[model samples]
Target: MAPDDQPAPPLRRRGARMRSAVLAATVDVLAEHGLAGTTVGAVARAAGVHETSVYRGWRTRENLILEALAEQLDAAVPLPDTGRVRDDLVTYFGALARLLATPQGEALLRLSAERDDTLPDHRLAYWSDRLDRGAVMVARAVERGELPPDTDPGLVIEALAGPLFTRALISGAPLDATLAPRLVDLVLGGASAPKPGA
Candidate 1:
């Protein structure tokens, strides 16, 4: 599927500016109050626009928030087809490590992890969408006989990304691009299923 955060085809100048302002407010609100408190009214206030503008434009608070998340995720980590799973993973993870160390990335991670049943499902769906898109890499590796057929792509992603998140959010360890290859090595060494007839 095409990336949901693809740039708008085009829009009138006023409309485009409004949308950009709203998205900027969305991130600000998420950083300040998180998911539960971020609403169309709040974002509109922060953006200095009418609530109707935000509501009419985004339809729901969830969409506005997710637009911000999707934009940042797309900018921070791009999935490239390098014809080799390990190389692709290294590139992806290295970029992620760098992003996670940034202020916006850290705020996004904290807000994304918030658990609020009253909120729209977009917060969690953001991750589901990410995994869905990322699975293509693992699937490609499987086709190349790098990973076993039964190996779970989502789990593999977790194995690779989870540690980076931990180091960034929990452990407060310094992040380095070099960690990407080491992470790929660890994930691959333990990722694939048992060899045939071992």
Candidate 2:
């Protein structure tokens, strides 16, 4: 076939690139205008796509925001397996506390706070998944004899995060760097420790 007569290869849309664009735009809109300010049209503009394109991919603004924020949350907290329960809990919560202490992390919390009835159930599911990942990691440690088998993973996870969120959202106190790991140790170690009277 003559070079000029060769048919052009069918153009393929890059799924990864498209997803990256969407995630990037989500973060941009979040950082720029927060949750209330974020809209399909604004995110589309930021991502260099039409509003309909975003809607086609995510179906709604709430869905798009949830996916984007979920991506960041996933990156923020990885499943911990450091071979020691105390070490693992410390590593996990410490990282989370650090993230919450940052400007982007604070903004992310604010975005979550702005959620209304229009928000989809998937957003709640997304957070639930993140919580489950942490729970599973701790559960494994309990199963391994590193932590007491009776130790409640859900309670442990809550203890690790509850105070941080409460202070940030309610009391307005700063997240003290020294307190996070110590709190993790108290819960995990306390549960596994033998009773003094026993």
Task: Identify the candidate with maximal TM-score.
Answer: 2
Off by over 4 Å in 2: 1-13, 191-198
lDDT of each: 0.80, 0.76
Residue pairs with backbone overlap in model 2: none
* Model 1 segments more than 4 A misplaced: 1-13, 32-42, 45-48, 190-198
Clashes of each: 0, 0
Scored by Cα lDDT, where does model 1 land? 0.80
Candidate 2 per-residue lDDT, tens place, 1-198, comes to 889996433123236776778788898788889877899988877777667768778898877888888888678867678888777878787788887887777777766666578774665666566777788878988788877778778877887888877766678788877778778767755867874446
lDDT of 1 by residue, 1-198 (tens): 479976443233248788887888888887788777888888888887888777788887767878988887787799978988888889888888888887778888877776766444877777878877777888888888888889788888888888888987789887887788877876887447553334
